[model samples]
Target: MRRAAWGFLTPFLALFALFFVLPLGYALVRSLYAVRRPGLGFGPASVEFAALRNYAAVLADPVFRSALGRIAVLGLVQIPVMLGLAAVLALLLDAGLARAVRWFRLGFFLPYGVPGVIAVLLWANLYVPQVFPLAWTDLLAPPYVLAAIGNIVTWEYVGYNTLILVTALQAVPRSLIEAAAADGAGPWRTAWSVKLPLLRPALVLTATFSIIGTLQLFSEPAVLRTITPAVSAGYTPNLHVYNTIFTDDLPHLGAAQAVLLAAVTFALSIAFLRVTRRWSAA
Candidate 1:
């Protein structure tokens, strides 16, 4: 049995190292090296190990710092709203309070099936005045653009989170629920007092996933960038890194920024998990 299990895992472990680990290691090594032109732009540029030069450059850039701050604000506002809506929908479905439960569930989850870029393109058209002509307001305006992107993200992932919560709800022991009922707990009280407590783990999962996704925000704003001037090349950290390497021809700086972004994501996720776990245990 052990031999068979190792054999089964070997293929997955090899692929994981090849596709994920190797590239990550390469990026880390490359980030420590930089491309430099020597002596009045008269010689061939060369890549040389510059230690923390790339990292320092990335850190000192105000544009990159602003990009990080932008996504921070977006996540703070969007994550809670999205997860709350998902929790409500999951609770409604679980309680059998809504009509056409199967259809409603499918409808809720359908947006997540749409490709991210495609969703952005669709929303871009809707936001464009010439395309859809909403005379009342402009979602693509500078002040509203971040919120607009947040709405797209919320639409795409709310269903996914809803399914997570719904699955968690299903695993809840019916005997516990019946006991709550016997204790004179109403449906609302039972859900608030019982089901919500049981969902802490799932909530933490969604929160961490959402946090990572928020930090790596790219698609929605990137697609909308073509339609709106509000989104700059440095609108989000991932997008900023993309523009840095491709647009500015600074792959070393991009690699450094990418590494830093990954590190930040990892640290934030770990910190959040520790705090949530402590709270849950309490």
Candidate 2:
């Protein structure tokens, strides 16, 4: 039976190896070797390796460094804001306040179902400097634009995170809450002393997911570029890699940047796992 199961999965494994693993291996190898074109730069024999020059150039490039820094800042800002709002919304949704629970739950979760590219496009139309009601084009333009972008991200993801936290909240036994209330605890006290602590695992899990997602944020900024001239080609790390590979024909550098981004994400995930382990132990 196990052999049959393995046989059934063989095709999927083979496809994964061919499409994903092989390309990743090729990109890693190519990242260390810059291509050089000889003669008129037109033909086959022209392409040759230039050693680790690509990796060195990518590491030394100011634009690449700036893109990384900008992304780090974006992550720092976005993750906390998104998670906090999600936590609050989750609490509200789980409170069972009224007969409108279904409507509120659906409304909150609706944005998560929207594709990221579509959400960005929707924001683009609304955030137009002249058409926008937020005064994004006036003297207070900078803050307005920042707030607008942040709002779009928060709006899109908060509902998803809320659902996660709400589900976690639901897993908490009702007996604990009743016990707390019997002991003279108020609703806020019960939530703070009983609910929040139990939701720690869920919060950490959501935060780690948010970190990974924020690090890879591309479509939102990319779509915004059509409406806002301030968002440049290298505005984000992913954007930098995209521009390098396709716009400038710097495939080697692009691969290097991608590898580095993947490494950072892996490290972040590992660190998050360690923290979760500690929390679980405590």
Candidate 3:
């Protein structure tokens, strides 16, 4: 049985190291070197070690700083709103408060099935006045673009989060809920006192996933960039990294930025998990 377990684990371990570990290692190494031209116009470019140069440049960039700030704000607002809606919907479905529960479940989760880029484009048409001709307002306008993107994200994932919570709800022993009802506990009272308390673990998991997703905000703004100048090349950190490498032709600096972004994301995720553990303990 031990040998069989090792056999099952070997393939996953190999793939994880090959795909994740190797790429991360390569990016870290790449961030330490730069392409240097020895002469003003005559020499061929060569790789040279300049360990701190790339990282310093990225850190000094105001746009990169703003990109980080933008996502921070977006996550603050969007994560709670998305999770709250998911909790409400999951409770409604679990209690059979709405008709056609099965159909509604499918309908809620369907947006998540659509590819992210396709969903962004579909929403783009609705928000871009040129395409829809009846768009109520310019959601892609500079001041509103971040909120617009948040709406798209919420629409895509709220259903996914709802289903996760719903599965958690199903795992709950039916007898406990029945006992609560027998004691004349109303739906709201039962949810607040019984169901919500039991949902703590699932809620924490979803919130953590939401935090990671918020930092990974790229494709929506990148897609929107094609339609409007509101999304600059450095609109989001990921987008900035992309344009830095491809558009500005600075792969080493891009790699540095990527590494720093990964570090920030990892740090924030760990902090959140630690805070939640403390909450659970208390």
Error of 1 at 134 (Å): 6.9
| TM-score computed on alpha carbons, candidate 1 | 0.94
**Which window of 10 residues has the lowest lDDT sum in candidate 2?**
138-147
**Which runs of model 1 end up more than 4 angstroms from their true locations?**
1-12, 128-135
| Residues 194-256, model 3: lDDT tens digits | 999999999999999999888878889999999889999998999999999999999999999
Alpha-carbon local distance difference test for all models: 0.93, 0.80, 0.93
Deviating ranges (above 4 Å) for candidate 3? 1-8, 129-135
RMSD values, in order shown: 1.8, 3.3, 1.8
Better lDDT candidate (2, 3): 3
- In Å, residue 178's CA in model 1 sits off its true spot by 1.1
lDDT by residue for model 1 over 1-282, one digit each (tens)? 999999999999999999978987888999999988888867799999999999999999999999999999999999999999999999999988999988988999999999999999888777766778672468889988998899999999999999999999999999989999999999999899999999989999999999999999998888888888999999999999999999999898899999999999999999999999899788
Deviation from native of the Cα of residue 134 in model 2, angstroms: 3.7
Query: Which candidate, 1 or 3, has the higher lDDT?
Result: 3
- Give residue 10's lDDT in candidate 2 (0 to 100): 100
Task: Report the alpha-carbon TM-score of model 3 versus the true structure.
Answer: 0.94
Off by over 4 Å in 2: 1-20, 39-45, 136-147, 279-282
